[model samples]
Target: MSGFPLPPNATIGIVGGGQLGRMSAMAAARLGYRCHVLTPEADSPAGQVSAAVTLGGFTDPATLRRFAEAVDVISFEFENVSAEGLDLLASIRPVRPAPSVLRISQDRIDEKTFLNAAGVATAPWRSVETMAELEAAVAVLGLPSVLKTTRLGYDGKGQAMLRSAEDLAPAFERLQPKPLILEGFVDFAQEISVVIARGADGSMAAFDTVENRHANHILDLTLAPARIPGAADEMAQAIARRVAEALDLVGLLAVEMFLDAQGRVLANEIAPRPHNSGHWTIDACPASQFEMHVRAVAGLPLPPATRHADAVMKNLIGPEGMALWPAAVAEPGLIPHLYGKTEALPGRKMGHVTRLFPRGALPGDLGVEAALGPLLSPLLSPLGVIA
Candidate 1:
């Protein structure tokens, strides 16, 4: 904790220039802060809008040093930032969601180990440092399991599904050189996430848990005030709180969980920054996730996280998002956000749209649930929207 306020107009250095950084920079601007975006791409969404842009790879030490010197504090949009790069910047300025936190979240083996050591329940998993060890891990976890790279995997990349004993070697063979982790498949009923913020002074606040729906390993939709039962919601929040305390974290952390058929919540993954599931906060809550993340990282006090509107956020992937933009913009209560991406390649996250309803106005009131069929229905419908 700095034990002092980061006054408005302070410059914050952002390590990645994706949509997350763009959103965070927007929030910082609203609060009278300036952003210096450091990334390799010149036309990145964040770089296009930020106060300053440093075009350099994360491995470029000299560029990172100059970037750190230009800002009062630093934070990252993505978890895959090189440890050596962040270490260089950390020497010059405060890096929130600190390097250590990033290290734990970046590696599957370390992440699961940290969660288990923190007394948090996660999917049963074992680590593999070699091909033989991978076979042993598969035997212990069982067939029909997931083999994930220990590092640099997301959006379902760098992972393989092993349906039988014969699949183990091939799965491991495909992801050679990188260590691995195998977990027994979870027969869960629901997937949800809690976006939490912890200030430098240790004060914490959390947005309502969001019910998440994923397709092809990428998040498709997120509904706030997750349609889960009261007890399940509380349990999820508690788990998030425990994780923040254990990590001694500052800035936003997204905790992903799975609710099994019996309604028990199991931790799935953790992101040490604002996440896709929290996008609904932009249209539904008083303080959006991006704003909270900036506040925490800048050493500002945490604000109350109050959900004033019920909301559903849908991610538009590939060309479909652009093709349907006209309809989205014409829809009442819909808020569209398009990233400054030129090409609309398949499976790429093009943008997102959020629909907000007045407080206490639920899907039942608007027939929204029925309007959203299986093809595009919001994820929270299974539990049914209460507000």
Candidate 2:
């Protein structure tokens, strides 16, 4: 933490060469820093833009050591990288936000345990390791709840909704890797998130609370400065900043939350790197979340997380989303960012389009579609387009 603001030519090592890493690397380059990426995929999204790429398994000892030795500072773009591998890298070069922070965010059990203890509100949950425990947890949490793997789950992959008694045994037998967690179902009115960056000296910058709308559990669009009441927005941002401070984080962290029907904010998940929800900042804010991440890990002074324009960020997922690319590019006032991805695979995030509004001019649900022009189609469900 002492000698920093990494020299201009110094390289920053990033684990997981995904789209998040790609954008972070692009941001780093703008600030006169170099990036080296490590991933198993050949020609990974992040690697396409980075100065160097180490193609290897996340747990490979040789690759971890070699990557650590090459960079002045290290950070990760995603949380799926093995914590043990990160610990190995930390021994050779500084890993900002620390491996300890990553450990807390890696597993749902550990994450929830940390959040509740940190005074951050979260859904009622119980860990289940066996059929008896599952039954007991179900009895306590009740019939309608969510059963999920405590690790390696994202985009709605590792969860089952239990609505009836018949769902118990089948769901319990189907889920893999054992040791699950049961969360009491929350009647949420809206989904929102906040992205924040914390520096080594504990200085922090938090972006506005943004509303997230999803389709099939994949993010579809995000509204910066969520249309919720001011108090609810404040609560969401406060939870994010609190999580950053609690972890003593020195990098970007995005905290997703459920604003319940009663106007209470409950933390859902925490990602210690850039999040899909924060992509709007790339076009709306002077210092994007990616830039905040680079500055924090490189020991540079943090900039205000200020935005000049209100923005609606739309995700380009799968082949359907990719189809809109031509219109997205042709439309005036739409800022397009395609993640150098070759294939438009199903459910994959191919790229994104951002539409800016004058400050305080974000439109209502009905108006949002008109603002987006030809980007949205009738085939999409109303939830994805807010019809």
Candidate 3:
């Protein structure tokens, strides 16, 4: 083994046993590493696939120590894993991306501050701690702004739109008792994300930019090689790289950005693990994001993140997604991945499907729609699928 490599038979500890952990465990197994999953829930999606599982709360010191002792290194699939838990485990075993990364990502104020300090531009925003401060923020940012909790918000939860003065009190009332952030909304042309992986040796690889679409605040579809002009595509990747380097990141980082009307890219959020937008890489790229993450954390050499095919990734959310499973399996060129969640609750991500086409083919390519018609016609008719 090399000086940095975690030898083949070593165990990798994973925090947050969700679908991302499940997929990361699968990739680690392929590279000859065993995975031990830690989560509070029994029979977690990741636990089902891992070699060992410890069921306990993240903040429990005993649980953290026991888990740390069993694994050669630790990595988390979700950002919400307790920072205190990671700090305890780090004394026993290495945690890639580090606990500091978690602290920065878990709070909106810290995240925006870090981004701006790194010389990345973000939407105009103000920190609001009380109703009076919120009112003051509104006077400056004006109506049509977004009010979100400073921490623990995702997928549109903990967020409210303030479209008019009349909406302020109700919005404040709904999001009160917790710190808040009011952001002046950006009138953007499209949303895109760049998923990049950085190795322990500082080697980095970035996948093709992905265009994202959302429905009811949930990720709906992702099209690889987002149809922006070449310059804008390069700019997005550069911004992602800068953020990763600034964070001193040693694992995967996903930078979500908005392309404004003038074609400027503004950082919106950063996820310090394998991300939903990069799902297309599983079918279209030389190395999937999950595998790249494993390689980075295990000290294995990074692979070139190159796309060989045009791809479209669609989320299977709720009952609507579950209903398409039968057809999804039978469709040619479609790769279906179910998260193994027993309950298909509304807004929950049950699975995803990726369809690949020839390189250079756009969504509007003649045969793309015809090929995906059967599997997507029902769920995507209203929202429309981007190529």
Best by TM-score: 2
State the displacement of the C-alpha of residue 25, model 1, in Å, after optimal TM-score superposition: 0.5
RMSD of each: 3.5, 1.5, 2.2
Candidate 1 regions off by >4 Å?
1-3, 364-387
The TM-scores of all predictions, comma-separated, are: 0.93, 0.97, 0.95
Q: Score residue 312 of candidate 2 by CA lDDT.
A: 95
Q: How many residue pairs clash in model 2?
A: 0
Ranking by lDDT: 2, 3, 1
Off by over 4 Å in 3: 1-3, 365-370, 377-387
Q: Tell me model 3's lDDT, rounded to 2 decimals.
A: 0.87
Clashing pairs in 3: 363-387
lDDT of 3 by residue, 1-387 (tens): 223589888898898899999999988999899999998889788999999999998888998899989888889886786667778988888889888988899999999999999999999899998889989998899889999988889899999999988888888889855789999898888899999999987899999898888888889878777989788898899999999999999989899999999999999999999999988888888789999999998899898999999898888899988988988898877899998899999999999998887898756533545655665654345246453
Residue runs of model 2 more than 4 Å from their true location after superposition: 381-387
How far is 49's C-alpha from truth in model 3 (Å)?
1.1
| Best model number under lDDT | 2
Q: In model 2, what is the error at residue 376, expressed in angstroms?
A: 1.6
61-157: candidate 2 lDDT, tens digit per residue: 9988988888888899867778678779888899987999999998999999999999999999999999999899989999799999999999999
Alpha-carbon local distance difference test for all models: 0.85, 0.90, 0.87
Model 1 residue pairs with clashes: none
Better of 2 and 3 by lDDT: 2
